[model samples]
Target: MAPELPFDDQEASTNLPLATQIFRFVVTGVGSGILDFGLTAILQYALGMPAGFAKAIGFVCGTTTAYIFNRRWTFRAEPSMARFVAVAVLYCVTFVVNVGVYTYLSHLWPETVLYSLLGYVIAQGLATIINFIVQRTVIFNIK
Candidate 1:
């Protein structure tokens, strides 16, 4: 049987390039963003939740999906509940930021879906940047 490679070794087996890894990361990020936005839209439209509440609920769902996917596939990192909790706490802060933006935009442009979507994009953009950095550098430790 072939020898078992460490998680890092398995990650590098792609041999594609750093650019490829970053590209994959962005793709994964967009998938996670879709999850966030879909859930937010459903909660706000179907359930008639406030934009802030919908965004918070969506943030939890999206971040959980992101953590699981990034751990197993994107970063190929070992799992740790403690690390999950830490990352979750960080996500909560982002959730508040998201809610603030969502609420403001809902007020500013009460009649338009575009403003709500734009607010979500802005909030999620900041959260995604922070999530990628923290997951790669601190939580997952890709290097």
Candidate 2:
């Protein structure tokens, strides 16, 4: 078997190319968004949770997944408690913005089948932009 590459070696593959970083980030975000959206839909439609609250709950799940994958796959960073807590705090700040946007948009449009997805998308898009930028620059920077 081939010898395992060090964490830094794996990270260098992702770190040099900005395009690669963005692509990986977007892929990770899309995966987590699907999880988040699906969970929110289930909570709101099946369990009768309010749209805003359901979205908040779902965001927690998605954020957790994103942190794990982004740390391991996207950024290739070894685990650290300080990093995890920093991410948690960042997610908390983003959570409010995410849910606030969802709430406002959900109010503007009825939470019908189609509009529910749209509202989620719009809010997720905002959070996605914020997440990608900060995660790459501040939280996960290796250089």
Candidate 3:
């Protein structure tokens, strides 16, 4: 038997379909990634900050954008304090996961642009998969 969704049909129907949700995720992620890379470049080059510090700033900005879009558009969940906390925790985990990948790649590549890019690619891909699973199954309680 199929499990009942927490939301009523009318509310659920208002949400985007799965394909639409994925499209929104990709669009939002690309926008956020651009913001991240821009900030990283400015901080690292213009401000003369270290790569790690610049990456930190970029990650925070990008993750903030992602949280807003994923919660409202990708999952279409109602906002609440508890939901925010749950999502925040998830972001924290993703932060560690992403930075760890970046740091590891940096060690291997030693100041190459590909190091940073590869780290972002792998970390973001993993984070996106985890976020979708956790948000739909647990935090939002979607069917």
Top of the candidates by TM-score? 2
TM-score per candidate? 0.78, 0.86, 0.79
* Model 3 segments more than 4 A misplaced: 1-15
Report the candidate with higher lDDT, 2 versus 3: 2
lDDT of 2 by residue, 1-143 (tens): 12232233453332535675666677888889999999999999999999988999999999998888778767666777777777887888889889999889889987786898988888888888888888778777643
Q: Give lDDT per model, in order.
A: 0.70, 0.80, 0.71
Which runs in model 2 stand beyond 4 Å of their true positions? 1-14
lDDT by residue (1-143, candidate 1, tens digit) is: 12222234454332334455466567667787899889988888888988888888888887787776666666665666777777777777777777777777787876456777888888888777777777666766523
Rank order by TM-score, top first? 2, 3, 1
Total clashing residue pairs per candidate? 0, 0, 0
Worst 10 residues of 3 by lDDT: 1-10
lDDT, candidate 3, 2-92, per-residue tens:
2233233434332456676667667778888888877876887688887777878888999898778666666666677887888789888
Q: In model 2, how large is the Cα lDDT of residue 108?
A: 93
- Of candidate 2, the 10-residue stretch with the lowest lDDT total is 1-10
Report model 2's TM-score to 2 decimal places: 0.86
Assess candidate 1 and give its TM-score to the true structure. 0.78
